[model samples]
Target: MPEIKSVPLSRAAAPRPGSASRPSAASLRYAAPALLGYVAVRITGVAILLIAASATGKDGMHRLAGRWDSVWYQRIAEHGYGYEVRLPDGTFHSDLAFFPLLPALERGLSALIPPLGVAGAGLLVSWLASLAAAGGIFAVGARLYGRRAGVLLAVLWGAYPTAFVQSMAYTETLFTALAAWALYAVLTDRWITAGVLCVGAGLTRPVAAALIAAIGVTALWRLFTAWRAGEPLRTQLQMVVGACLAPLGWLSYIAFVAVREGHPFAYFDVQADWNNRIDGGAALAAFVVEQFGRNVFAGLGLCAAFAFLFWVLWLCVRQRPRQPLPVITYCVVVVVISLIGSGYFGSRPRLMMPAFPLLLPAAVALAGARRRTLPAVAVGVAALASGVYGAFTLLGSGPP
Candidate 1:
């Protein structure tokens, strides 16, 4: 592998003179290879899933758009949210725990086209969002590293172990698309654009807190630097405006829930009912220790996996032409949120799907490979493994 070179921070953070932050026709053309590669990987995964589903006499489409959280989203779309379930354990699971953006999209889209039901509309939204996410990921990578790295970064995201979720009727793809573009906007100094995208992300998922924090932190840092440099307030006004706008969507939803439930912390209460409230990793530690009692190898493997996650994160932290402050902040918050939550252990990877920045190290390495065919071979193997795992997990008794 060739060593990856880093650009100076000033060069990395500042857009080239006269270059627009928004993608141009030329930028789209440059990103076409990445988009196509992402599509191909996703298509291959779906193909494998369909073949496996057929062999087992199962409906792949239904599995993709009608299972687990997908059902919750569709229910919200078709009948709006007052749904709840009383579990045998005397706990309640309320639909309000879910964010409303995906459901809203499903309802609107299905209403526009009668032939596509709510579920079908959800699948459509997810599929399209996945493509947009690929484009945004490519743009970020290309800006920081180069076109080749950008292409690999997008493709690698599509070939993630839990990339299967990107195809299902879930908010992961939609949130990721918004988050990726939002980070890109921050990188390019398009403060208001970043904040707008952050608003969309906030409306889509509670994890939008990470994106909100990233934007807030980045804006504060910019304000401080600008002030120290004696830059005028007019130039820093957009940063302040963007930071203010970034949290509104999330705050609005929380306020809505508070009013609806007649409690100040109704949103947190709802999450607690679903057992997803953050516990500072206490639950995660206990779960891992319990796994050791059940099966030592499984416990060891889990520990190793977590170690690997942190190692990759460290790589991101130390990445050459270092990642912008917003990117690092976003990725770190996403990981922390994913691990500290007391939700079902099986869902952690899916929760972390929006943390696409963690894959930067691997993308960089692949881009620096000496053998031209090495990256393609690695991607092929990864896609194959991911597809197999996805089929098994999706078809098994548990939710993925």
Candidate 2:
């Protein structure tokens, strides 16, 4: 079991091999390539996507950059949450459509390096979030599973085509970083810190509700276990605090939006306008059919969703490697809700972004892969192709 020493949130290092035995330089050196490989793939994926967009036309490419959400993030980065946009409907739309954390980070980074307005800030945030995410994944796999799993986790994340989403201004990287760290903290029994981080994550994206829900369940389970064992009253109290963390982000944002947008639920209404509504089977089917016909990346997006379902079942049955049940549960729930509850098919896969960490266990399993290097190469190539699919569409618009 990982040691539980009370430390400040900022002071807490990821649980190591033990309190005494730190990993060696050799271990660090061994991990470098796997980490670098994941990063390289993400960068290449972004470049390819940009090229594809440039070659084709800006319309599709703009969508790839997430004009819908990214533009809001950009708007937020440019101007903090003001909550009043004159919508096509003529009534005001809430800035609450964009959460606070990403813009907060963008503004912070811009203040630090003025040259990095929103785009630069987004890029820097993505890179840092990616690195933090890799670290959290490594810490989770290594501490809970093993060192090999950690290396594989890093490689898998770096090599993921979805990493391209991070390459642009997408909020996945930031949310993942926060979620991973928060998960790590939860596992380590740092409940208050976990709650705070979860709150940050909630502010980053609504999907973070999954992470928060998972952590809340896990914390409750632990509290129950403690009560059964008669551990202590204080531990249970921490559970209460931790349970409160994740919702703070969303609630605060909603409150802010209510003040600015007239209706507290205005964000959801705006989402409906952009095709992000909650509906059942028929609505989702329409989206899937449309996205399948729209482009190749969309098709890959569908394939990955199904692939995740099959793979998760295999993980649950075969290895049953214990880490966070909530992690898997969170993923399954988010995926189902997004796919089914979501009104837009084109948005399903993108909405399924939180499942990115599920790739860690698969990567770990691949540690013993027969052709390890090839999987890396294969994934890298696929990412480049999928990401750049729009670049070809973007460039035909009369630009170099």
Candidate 3:
């Protein structure tokens, strides 16, 4: 066994070992760069993408600012989600698909300050959420690897081109923030708190199934290990309670959707009516091919979607080849479930955004690699360029 050296903030580090209640040098040293770098990178990416999109016209822009997703999100912010009459289908599609949490948060914050309007409130929430999430990511990384790797991981995700999604009226920032806190809680064995945060995350986005699944796996591992080591049953029981909280809300929603129709998976049926459901893997595969066949850029986006998933799996394999069973299980399952499920491939990038944290260590390691730096920089530039182009095309193309 490796000797555990005493860290500087012994008293403060007790139990969880890291908390804002008492300041510690290690905490600030690691968390500061991560926070600052995220802010700088996001501002820079948005600016660069904005400028490039302006220069390139529609093709270039679609790759940049993104499309009506942001607009629909804002609409939900202004007007609550409700079913609007279309044509044939009597089934209601809640503009509610946008979800209520982000807008509700924005409105709540804006009401607190007299001067801040809905827009200002929304920005404030995203801004704070982004910073806090990066901090949480830093804590996780630092604990798992080292301070350098942790900070680098946080910065990598913080500066990612798609981070603009966090800054917008979307729920990515909220979801990321909740997931980070939940992960931090799990790592520290704050089971109840972790479950609470996961519940919040699940409400933010259905994808939180990944977090719950991961936590459950981790808890089960703990239970098995405890039994093998001849530990008490109470500890294992508590872990079970902690892991179960993460999925309660999601399950309830699915049940509600099912009750609304004749069956539980009826949500998929309604979703299909929106041109948003998948017939099967064959349908999705054929659709993806058709999309890529549409144009050079569409093909590029498709490639990016696949690459993003691969990136997460690749990092998980390399860095945590033998990670806590729960973390690996949750991440792999979520990515697979998402890939196989129905939805437009274009949504995949955003859907897969939570996987951003996986990019950190690799980026950090690459940062130290004097030779690999150039190629890394080139790939980032290309990604930024595509995001910019995508944004413009999105505005012109209207809703998907």
Candidate 4:
């Protein structure tokens, strides 16, 4: 496979003697441009949002840290779970639907500073996590392609349509940060570190199931290859241990919910109340069909959007040097989960933010642009478009 030639698993698993164990000052310098570009894109997006909010007489800060799901996270931070609201239709909206890590962090930060409050703490966590996520993305791209591709990858991610969520009091940035670093750890052959970060990702969002699946699959593949080649048992054991640890955080939370609710599948039941269920895309198909029945243009638009997503996935798969198994597996799993689940349609893009690998092809193309200024111009245009879209959606009645 191209991946074997490009990034051999065995070689990554064992570092050379005298090499730095973790990112060093030089590594930070290397990724500074990508981090700076990402921050610039995000700042531009926020500035646009603020201007739009001012024009509409809406509070942008409140929208970012106090509205919709942010409210639920802050509520969890301020008071432990067991909060629920019943809609007129008799469905229960329970706090148990949210994972605990973000709230736990908000609670800790608020207590530490006292003046920051839960909302402020949540925003701070998201902002910092976004930068970390950008750096990790740069590292991964730089490892796979080159510094230029890596830089473009980070900038493009910041210019994503739902990139505004990265600046909000949301789990997307936190989960992306953990997921990116975990993938980087896997790329560099640090299985234990990957497992630990996977645990954190699992704690932050249900989407971490994708991350866990990626790690488990990669580890199993490595073990199979090693056994056939008669590789060292120590390496195999490390892979086994990491694979075993990957799902503990997600499973533990489910077990907690089950015990608390006095039902073996209480977690699923909680999610069902929120209309979040894995239905093999049945609900999505129904939604599209209903859209067609109501408005042909809206239905066509939805179909085009899905087609675009799959096209990007195809581009990712067709890259010159194949992506590592974990990267490909993780991206595919994230996309599958986003499409197959039944829930609020508008939130699907935000939920897929951690599927950063989807941007690899675009980043590579930008990096290889004939004109030196072409990449910058393209990224600038994308950032502007993203900013305007973010402002519009954020100011609208619906959740982004």
Candidate 5:
């Protein structure tokens, strides 16, 4: 019980006897291959986008940074919300549906350096956030596994099917950066930092619910064992207070929406306007079935989509790399929300982007591959595929 209390409840799993400790500068230096691999993938993605855009006579930069959700965020930053678009079907989509932190950062940075502009600032935020997220992922993986596994984890995250979103003027990268660091803080027992980052993540995206739940559960576990562990009063108070702080950003946003829209549940109603609701994967399951029946190939593709998800999940559980409770909880919640949420079936992969823990098993496998060249080759092939897909998606249709 004392040992259990000492290990973070955020990661309720038992710690390995020789789990690597916190990452240091030297560890980061050793992560060069991972960092370089990520950069190479990003470059490939961007290069493909540029080439496709040129062939079509469109501005590549604008397409990547100024369309879809990016436009909505820029509008929010430039005009301070209160915007709405009523679809032909009569559903009103409100800018309030978008969270605030990304736009707020865009607004501030664009103001500080006028040349950067809103879109440019957004891209800057995303690029920087991607690096931060990578570092955090590497740190977490290194601590739990080893430097090799850590590096591979970061690289795999960069090669994710929706990795292109990390380069866009979107909130995904920003939210992921906050989440990775917040989880790291939890693992390291930095309760205050974890709470603060969770707050920021809450402000950036609706999925902050998962993060808050993780923090709250961990805090509760800590409190339950405080006496057995002989925890000092100060530490217990900090743990409780930090947990309390986790939900304020999300609640504050909800309250603001209520006040602004003249209804206590206006935020939820607005989400319904976009068909974004928790349907317990019923909608997702139906979507898969429908797709499968439409065209055999398309159906197979859809099946493959879910198959990939389950495969990663199976690996994570099978590897069971001595993760803490918070990491496990965060990973499960993100997967649930991503898969079970209604509408935006195309966006589900992007939504699952922050569930970095799923990569741990794959990373472990890659790290143990007898032939070092095989991992590099695998990453290269994946990057090429990802780049082509990202370019096609951005150049061909409605924002990715």
Candidate 6:
């Protein structure tokens, strides 16, 4: 595979016998540039948002941190669940459809810091999680490819069109952070860490179902191989334990919803209320084709969007032909769930943010650039475009 090679966890953890016992400083040195680059992109996006808000007499900070899904999360934090808003058209918006982990963290932090409201707490968590995400991305890239590729990987993830969500008081950053680290753990064969992070990711978003599936499939496959190879019973048992634990958080949430709503499948039913369900991309295709009838320009835009996603998926397959089973499974499942599930059309880009594996090919290209200036210019242009899009999306009518 041209993507990167996977290194085991113990090899990564252990230093040469005569070397320093830890690589903390080395990691920081490698990660600092990527984190700074990402934050710079986010700051530019915020600055654009601020200018746009000022010109329109709007509160950009509030819009950035308190509107749309941010508002939903804060509502869940401040006032528990069971809240619903009935639209004039008779459709209902219920808080129950949202996941709970991010809100729970917001609520806890808000209490810990009396001066910081739930929104502020949420932002705090989001920013920190974004940094952690960058680090995890770096770790994965470094282990798979090299440190340079790792740096590019982190920067590329931050340059995503929906990168602003990493800065907002949303669950994307937190979920991505957990998912990246969980994937890293899997790569390193840290079964316990992978299982725990998978649980956390599962708690943060329904998309975590994809992560759980990846972990389960990988663990079970490894367990069977270990059994056939006559590996130690303890070694096989760890895989079983990790796979078993991966889905608990998601299942627990469903049980809670079922109990609260007095139905066995109330969680799925609640999602149906919001027009979110798995329809094998029927709704997505309809959404794209309708754009042509309503507005040819938008139809072109949708075409470009679809083309871009298809290209990324193609790169994922073609560029990394020999990717580790966990990486391939995780990335493919993430794309499948993101595209196949029925949800708000506008939010699809944001939904795709967690599929960080899609960036691997781009990262490899950037990492392999002969002239340093080329990658720099590419990332710079991407960051600028990301900033403009983010500002426009946050300031526009609909939610991002």
lDDT of 4 by residue, 31-101 (tens): 99999999999999999999999998999988888888999999999999999999999999999999999
Show where candidate 2 strays beyond 4 Å. Answer: 1-31, 49-68, 82-94, 262-264, 287-321, 370-375, 386-400
Tens digit per residue, CA lDDT, model 2, 86-205:
768765555666778888787788889998667667767877787777766676666555666676676666554334565566688788778877776776767787889888888888
lDDT of 5 by residue, 1-400 (tens): 0011133333543344544453352256766766777777788888988998899898888876889899999999999989999999999998999999999999999999999999999999999899888878887787677678888888888888878888899998899889888888877777888899999999999999999998898788777777677867576787777788899889999999999989999999999898998888988888878887888898898888679889878666544435666777788889988988887788888888999999887787788888879788888888888888888888778453
Question: TM-score for all predictions?
Answer: 0.96, 0.78, 0.77, 0.94, 0.91, 0.91
Cα displacement (Å) at residue 237, model 4 = 2.1
What total of clashing residue pairs does each candidate reach? 0, 23, 24, 0, 7, 1
Q: Which digits, one per residue and each the tens of the lDDT, describe model 1 over residues 1-400? A: 3465665654556764455754641277888999999999999888999999999999887889999999999999999988999999998999999999999999999999989999999999999999999999998888776778889999999999989899899999999999999989888778898999989998999999999999998788777877887989788787788889999889888998899999999999999999988899998999999999999999999999999999989888887356778888999999999999998898899889889889888888899888989999999999999888888888886354
Worst-scoring 10-residue span by lDDT in model 3: 4-13
- Clash pairs of candidate 1? none
**Candidate 6: residue 372 Cα off by (Å):** 1.2
What is the lDDT, from 0 to 100, of the residue 211 in candidate 6? Answer: 87
Best by lDDT: 1
The sequence of per-residue lDDT tens digits that candidate 3 reaches over residues 1-400 is: 1222333221211343444444332366547877876676666655665665566563433332224555555555666555443656566555535445777776677668847766666667777888878887777766655565666677677555455566565677788888877777776667888888888887777787788887887777677767887999796665688888888866765666678667868656666656665445565687767877888688678668678658758766554532334445656766665676567655655666676555644655654556645534744564465445435433345323
lDDT of each: 0.88, 0.64, 0.63, 0.87, 0.82, 0.81
As for model 1, its CA RMSD to the true structure in angstroms is: 2.0
List residue ranges in candidate 4 displaced over 4 A: 1-26, 398-400
Off by over 4 Å in 6: 1-26, 294-301, 319-322
lDDT of 4: 0.87
